[model samples]
Structures are given as structure tokens and as C-alpha cells.
Target: MSARGSVTAGRARSSSRDSILDSAGRLFGERGYSSVTVRDIASAAGVSAALVMKLYGSKEKLFAVAKPTEALLTDLDVPVSELGAALVFCVLMRRERGLREPWAMMPCTIQDTPRPEATRAKTRERYLAGTAGLMKDTTPDLRYASTVVALMTGFGEAVRTLGLFDGWDFDELVAHYAAIVQAQIDACQLAGQD
Candidate 1:
């Protein structure tokens, strides 16, 4: 094959790979890992199952690549006093932009997958650890960090997954929810100082 032909083929391959990953991410996020199969992702991506296997080897490998571990709060520089609002605002903005919060899918995965223990471990390592890191300056208590994580996860699930507060004013929702989160943070900080 000519160099031009090789380049075209490479681009096609790259596009297919990207499509597969995109499909996998959406399906796993929506339905959880065990509920989705390679053929399902392949069909969604408009690629052959053989191609997916050739590229990612297995469902597990594809999941590892597709799972997102985005830091819960991208900008952690917010003052502790305002961290609640910042965190709530970030999540709401992402929802408005139609972004998926993979950590919010943990409950689905835990309930749906056969290997619940493994799923729980992954959640702790990837999701909880990352969120806790963002709160390191506010408190060193794992219990407090876990509470914050729970609140965010529940909030995301209710807002995004369940559409509990659809059509609500963004600012109003954020203010109400952020106040609850702020109370938790304040208590944690006070406990730490004692």
C-alpha cells in the first residue's frame, strides 16, 4: 500500500476505536458493566464485535478505558467557606452540558454486576479517593469525606439520572443544595479544629 493509503487506513482505524470507546462509555454509564455486552457496544458504535475485541481484547479492558474518573470539583481553589456552592455549581453545569458523571453510576453497577465487591473497590479507589483529595484541606476525616461523596452522588443521581428536579431554576437548586453541603463541611471543619 502507498503511504497515502496507509494514512487513510490508520484514520479509519482510529475513528472506529474512538467510536467503540464512546459507545462503551455511554452504555456502561447508563446500564452498568454486567448489563452491557461487547456486541451491544459494537452495535451501538456501528462496528463489528471482532473489531472491538481486536482493539480492546475484552469487556473488562474496554470498561477500564471507558470509565471516567473526573475530579468531582475541577477547580479546588475555592475557599472552604464557598466550596459547597462551587461543588454544587460544577455538578449542575456539567448536567446542563449533558455530561455524564460516571461515579453516579456506581449504585447501578453494584446492584447489576456479579462482582459487587470488585465494583465497590473500584468505586472507592477511583471515585471516592479523587473526591476526598479535593476536600483534603477542609478535613482529614474519612467519615466526613465519605459523607460528602455520598451527598454528591445522591444529588447527581437525583438530578441527572432520575431527573427529579427537571426545569427547576439552576441558581435556586444550587443554593438550596449547597446550603446542605456547606453545613456538613462546616461541622467537619469544626470537629477537625477541636
Candidate 2:
């Protein structure tokens, strides 16, 4: 083939790779880090498993670029109540839209190892910082803020598992989790309350 033809072919291959990563990102976010397999991602990307492996090295590597953890972490300028609203809206919508990975839990395979702990710690730090930006200043203490973030993540995962929000619209589900977390925060405010 001529030089021009070869250049065009190379561009096409590059485009295909970008497409593959886009699909993988969506899958990883929706299914969670562990649940999404290389095969699944490749199939979604319309590529072979070997290609996925060759291009990405591994799912974890692919995830690093495709589903960036830092993108979701943010400093909220609003109050805790508003912050909760934004989180429920974002995380749940992400789940519904296949953008937020539903699986953050450490799988049985990694249950005894420190491998998953590091990722979890990063997630925890990022998530809390985002949540804390809102509650940190107002709360008498930031201690419960960690609990609040944990509850939100865990409950959000459960809600996805139970499929309880299937028919319920996004706004409704956001309101629900927001209320639940708000209650927890409020309870924390009570001097004697645990």
C-alpha cells in the first residue's frame, strides 16, 4: 500500500483503540472494578481478549485510564445537605447510566491480601474529601464525616444490588439516600447520641 493509505490505516486502528477504551470505561464504571472482565470489555469494544490484554496490559491498567478515580472526587462548596443531594444524584445516576462502578468491595480472592486495601484507601480518601468539603466546616467534628461517606457508599451499593430504585426515578432515589445520610449526620450532632 502507498504511504497515504498506510497513514489512513494507522489512524483507523488508533480510532478503534480509543473506541475500545471508551467502552471499557463505561463497563468498568457500571459493573465495578472486579466484576468487569477483560472479555466483557473487549466484546463491548468489539475487540478480542488478546487485543484488550495487549493494549491495556490488564483490566486494572485499563481502568486506570478509562475510569479515572480522580474525576469523581471533588471539593463541594455547598452545605452537607446539598452535598448529599449532589452525591446521590451523581453516584446513583452513574450507576443507572453505567458510569459509576457498582463494585467497590474487595472480592473473596483478595479478601486476605493487602492488594485491594490500597485501592480502597484511595477511594476512601477521595470520597471523604469530596464529602468532607461540605460537612467539614459545619460539623462540630469531621469524625462522623467518615462514617457518613462509608454509609453512603455501602448503602448505594446495596441499593444497586437490590434493584430497589429500578422504577423510582433518579430524583427520588437521590432524595432517599440524602435523607438517610442527613439523619445519620444529625444524630451524630446529638451530644449523647452514637
Candidate 3:
């Protein structure tokens, strides 16, 4: 193939791969891991099951590929004080984009799968690491860190479930929720210093 044709083929392949991932993500989000199948994903993406396997190897690997864990982790890199706001903003942005809450899938994967234990464990560890990173303090109390993590995840889940952002100002809600999250982090920081 000519170089120009090769470039066009590469773009087409990239587009197909992305569409597959997008279909898989939507399916997994709508129906938990246990409920979704490779065939279902292939049908949703308008690809053959064999083709899906060829591209992603297995259902588990496809899920790992579909996950936005890296993007989620990057949200945790903001200033510790803005961590809560930034985290919540990330969730809201996903919803605004009509995408599923990627973090929410971790619990489902853990509860719903017997295989892929290592993948699930890695995801859990990453989530914990993100939580710990938000503390930004040496010797952070484990209990306090857990609370902050729970609050962050719970707030996001609740907003998604309740449609709390419906007809509301996104920025205002983010600031308000961030204050609550910051308060918890502040307490943790103070506790460590005492």
C-alpha cells in the first residue's frame, strides 16, 4: 500500500478500535460485568465476536482497556486543598459527556467477578493510592484517609444516581461539594499534626 493509503488505513483501524471500546464501556456500565458478554459487545459495536477477541484477547482485557483509570488518577494530582473539588468536577464532567462513572465499576468488578482477581485488586489499589495522594500529609491516619475516599466516591455516586445536577449550575455545585470534601481533608491534616 502507498504511504497515503497506509495512513488512511491506520485512521480507520483506530476509529474501529475506539468504537469497540466505547460500545463495551456503555454495555458494561448499563449492565454489570457478570451480565455482559463478548457477543453482546460485538453486536453493540457491529463487529464479530472473533474480531473483538482478536483486538482485545478476552472480555476481561477488553474491560481493562475500556476503563478510564488513568484519566481518573490524573484528577487526583491537583493541589490537596482542591482535591475534592477537582475529583467531583471530574465525575460531573464524565456525566456531562454522557459517560459512565469509571470508579463506580471497581466495586462491581470486585463483587461480580471470580476471575481477573489481579486486575480487580490492581484497580482497588490504584483507588486507595489516589485517596492517599489527596491527603498530601506525611503519616496520614488510615481511618481518616478511608473516610475521605468514601466521601469522595459516595458523593459522586449520589450525584449520578439522583441527577443532582439537573438544571443546576455545575460550577456552583462543584464548589459547594469541594468545601465539604476539603473540610474532611483539613481535619485529617490537623489530626496528623497533633
Candidate 4:
């Protein structure tokens, strides 16, 4: 093929890969990881199941790579002090009616798989890394970081699993939850000073 043809082909491949990942992310968020098949992702992306398997190797690998946590965390774009509100925005307030944040569903995904200790370990490490990054110079103790993560995850899961906050006003719920999260961050900051 000509050089121009090669470039075009590369672009096509990249586009297809992105489409597959996007579709997989959405499907996984909506249906939970175990429930979503590569065929389902392929259908959503308007591609063949074989193509997805060929590109990602397998369903588990695809789920691991297609996790949206890194993107979701980076997109917050706020100071460390306000990270809680940012998280609340991404995981809770920003979703459509039925869509769940992929990261918020990750623990459930990890639970559903057999012998996923390695995956779970990686996820725990990533969670700590990401939280530490958000904590910045706040002297991020892993214990506090884990507690903060649990708080955010608990709130998000409560909203998702039990519709715990659905009846409350959106702004009010976010405010109260963000305040609670902020308190944790504040406590961490105070502890760091000692």
C-alpha cells in the first residue's frame, strides 16, 4: 500500500479500537462487567465479536483496559481540597438516569470473577495511587485515603444500588455528601500537620 494508504489504514484501526473500548465501557457500566459479553460490546460498537476478541485478546483483558477510572479521575480538574466534590460530581451527579460510573462498578466486577486476586490487587494499588495523587501534599496516609475512597464509593453505591439519594434534591445531596467528603480530607490534612 502507498504511504497515504498506510496512514489511512492506521487511522481506521485506531478508530475501531477506540469505538470498541467506548462501547465496552458503556455496556460494562450499564450491565455490570460479568453480564456484558464481548458480543454485546461488538454489537454496540457495530463491529464483529471476533474483531473485539482479536483486538483485546479476551473479555477480562478488555475489561481491565477499558476501565474508565483514570479518565474519570483526571477529568475532575479541581484542587486537592475539593477532590471530594469533584468525585461526587463524576460518580453521582453527572450520570444519566440509568448509567453508572464504570469505576464505581469496579468492585462488583472484581467480585464476580473467579480467582481475580491479581486484578483486585492491581485495582487496590491503582486506587491508592489515584487517591494519593488527589491528596497531593496532604501527607496521604493509606488508611485515610482508603477511608475517603470508601466514603465516596459507599455514597455512589448507595445511590446506585438502593437509590438511597434519588428522592433527595440533587444539589442538596451533592452538597451534603461533598461536605462529608471534605471533612475527611480536612481531617487528613489536620493529621498531617501533627
Candidate of highest lDDT: 1
lDDT, candidates in the order shown: 0.76, 0.63, 0.71, 0.73
Ranking by TM-score: 4, 1, 3, 2
Between prediction 1 and prediction 2, the one with superior lDDT is 1
lDDT of 4: 0.73
lDDT of 2: 0.63
Off by over 4 Å in 3: 1-70, 115-123, 137-141
Candidate topping TM-score: 4
Measured with C-alpha atoms, the lDDT of residue 38 in candidate 2 is 86
Candidate 1 clash pair list: none
Model 4 misses residue 96 by how many Å?
A: 3.0
lDDT of 1 at 71: 33
Off by over 4 Å in 4: 1-71, 137-141
Weakest ten-residue segment in model 3 by summed lDDT: 67-76
What's the TM-score of every candidate structure? Answer: 0.56, 0.47, 0.56, 0.59
lDDT of 3 by residue, 1-194 (tens): 99999999899778778878988876664444566899999998888899899888999999877842224654345567776776677777677646677655556667677667877677656776667666754453466566766776677667777665677688898888888877878877787778
How do the residues 1-194 of candidate 1 rate in per-residue lDDT, one tens digit apiece?
99999999999999999899888876665445666899999999999999999999999999878842233554355677887886777677567646676546768878798898987888776665665566553454477678877898899888878889898898899899999988877777778787
Q: Model 2, stretches more than 4 Å misplaced?
A: 1-71, 75-77, 102-114, 117-122, 137-141, 185-194
Model 4, residue 65: what's the lDDT?
A: 81
